[model samples]
Target: MDSTKCLPRLGGDSSFELGLECREIAKTIKTRKIKYFGHIKRHTSFLKDVLEGKIEGSRIRGRQRRQWVDDIAEWTGKGIRQCTVEAQDREKLRSVSCQPLEQGRLRE
Candidate 1:
């Protein structure tokens, strides 16, 4: 895919560079996932439990698996508990989720 179209052109030799489209897409997906999780009733949602790591079990020994919550935390610069609290308010969650993208800090 052509990343240039997704990125802004710089006028000169500046240090700033646009983030990858894949990162942007991942961010969007993470936002949507969190929003959906927020809408679910915490009492009966298995997915919510999984997202919050409420289920207790040992993982097989190897490289640790990546988690949705971890991705969201890394992207938003917020802890999972803070994210969960903010996600309770749909509008607030949306605004917070979009902040990194707006500031062009989506790079790893």
Candidate 2:
């Protein structure tokens, strides 16, 4: 798949690095998951921990934000919803989350 073509804007701004931007975009991307599109969701999460000092820092390098966005775009386009495995992440999610379909959706 041409990931570059499907890329959405990574939320980079003065207050934070692309890591923080990654978090915001992740939050936005999570919004489209099939079974939970309209539900409230977390944006930063791991990154939020970084900001809040609960964790040391994000392992994600700033240079990778674009690729991350592209990967998420592909996954979301295909209806694959990925959740962080932390117990809190599970609690934050909707009960019946959508998994990826083996075959692509039919189209005209």
Candidate 3:
């Protein structure tokens, strides 16, 4: 008997055996980022300033990279300013952060 032929019968998919659907690492990272954004916004820290402040220097001659806040805004479907306001409420932010990504958009 060929061992390869028995693989499917033994449940070759690890996710099925684990009793959980596999999730992309990108989704997990986005979720953590949203939570961390709320934490920083709620507390008084230098990191908060760095996140919200613009750098004072000459611009580099190349395509600009995406900002951290921009990622949060895109993921949440909200403006950066609005995100800052909403982040003040822990419960609201937690709910928003936990929303699952679907079809390139977040589920309410």
Candidate 4:
């Protein structure tokens, strides 16, 4: 609760004077933590949530590349571990498409 809550605003009073009354007032109310999605890490978390079905995105409709992860887990419940496996699969696919003929020629 205190993680994102204000703690008496560093001490103050309703009359704009330094007093303990204001401190008590601020402590009574609770504050909520902020949730935002930024960068790949956050996307990965959202992907986890997708697998858990904690949030709804299928109703979003259309081509949901970012939200596409949600549909994949809709039928089968998946977790971050599955996401990791899928990433490895993609890497393998990528490696298969590349040509390694120049590797020996470029090396000593």
Candidate 5:
């Protein structure tokens, strides 16, 4: 049996650790989401209203689904208002978004 086949190989790194790769990918995704949200925040558009849940709709039965902003808040360990405020500053948003997964209690 080839042990290498069972592990993910990162570029130029002999160590094949799937957990590390997953963390990296998660960070990248978080960063992108933050940046995108920031962009939306700076603009006046339907998407913004949608993200903010401004659009009135009938409530669905059962547990409420998590919104994008909720995910951002959870990822940054901040409230929705704080996340929106931070998103206003590009540099701060980038820094917050790049934080390690452990720093943010990500829900499974």
Candidate 6:
């Protein structure tokens, strides 16, 4: 039970022969966020308000920070308003969220 033996070795032909591939962390995170947006949209709760950046507060006056919705909008290549409409349909949202960014746009 050697610890070194349990870990996948780095930069070797064996690693390739084993068919190991590096996961795209950013893509994975973005996909999960998109899925969570769908989940929030399907529910009737304050979480929706929070997700939409409607919290009660004043910002420190420099520049506005990006909202959670903003990332989803960019990733999905659709306006926030349109995303809201599409997110209402769970099956469609699931399909859109899991697709690669290039093909994730809502069908016209």
For each of the candidates, the C-alpha root-mean-square deviation to the true structure, in angstroms, is 7.5, 17.9, 5.9, 20.4, 5.4, 6.7
Best by TM-score: 5
Summarize candidate 2's per-residue lDDT along 1-108 as a digit string, tens digits: 655666466554644786567655555444444223322234545544442243356776566433222333353443223433321364433332343322322121
Question: Candidate 4 residues 1-108, lDDT tens each?
Answer: 457866554434455554455443332211000011112223456554554465445456677455433322331234444533443454532332232222211111
Over 4 Å off in model 4, which ranges? 1-66, 90-108
Q: What TM-score does candidate 4 get on C-alpha atoms?
A: 0.18
Q: Which regions in candidate 1 have their CA more than 4 angstroms from the true location?
A: 1-27, 41-44, 53-57, 101-108
Q: What digit string (tens of lDDT, one per residue) describes model 3 on residues 2-23?
A: 5555444445576565544334
The alpha-carbon deviation from the true structure for residue 21 of candidate 3, after best TM-score superposition, in angstroms, is 6.5
On the 0 to 100 scale, the lDDT of residue 7 in model 4 is 52
Clashes of 4: 0
Give the per-residue Cα lDDT of candidate 2 at 35. 26
**How many residue pairs in model 3 have overlapping backbones?**
0
Q: How would you order the candidates by lDDT, starting with the best?
A: 3, 5, 6, 1, 2, 4
Between candidates 2 and 5, the one scoring higher on lDDT is 5
- The ten-residue window of minimal lDDT in model 4 covers 29-38
Residue 61, candidate 6: C-alpha displacement in angstroms: 1.6
Give the TM-score of each candidate: 0.53, 0.21, 0.69, 0.18, 0.70, 0.65
Q: Which of candidates 5 and 6 is the stronger one according to lDDT?
A: 5
* Range of the 10 consecutive residues with the lowest summed lDDT in candidate 1: 99-108
lDDT of 6 at 50: 73
Error of 1 at 35 (Å): 2.4
Q: Which run of 10 residues does model 2 get worst, by summed lDDT?
A: 99-108
Show pairs that collide, candidate 6: none
Q: What is the C-alpha local distance difference test score of candidate 5?
A: 0.75
Model 3 earns a TM-score of 0.69
Query: Which pairs of residues collide in model 5?
Result: none
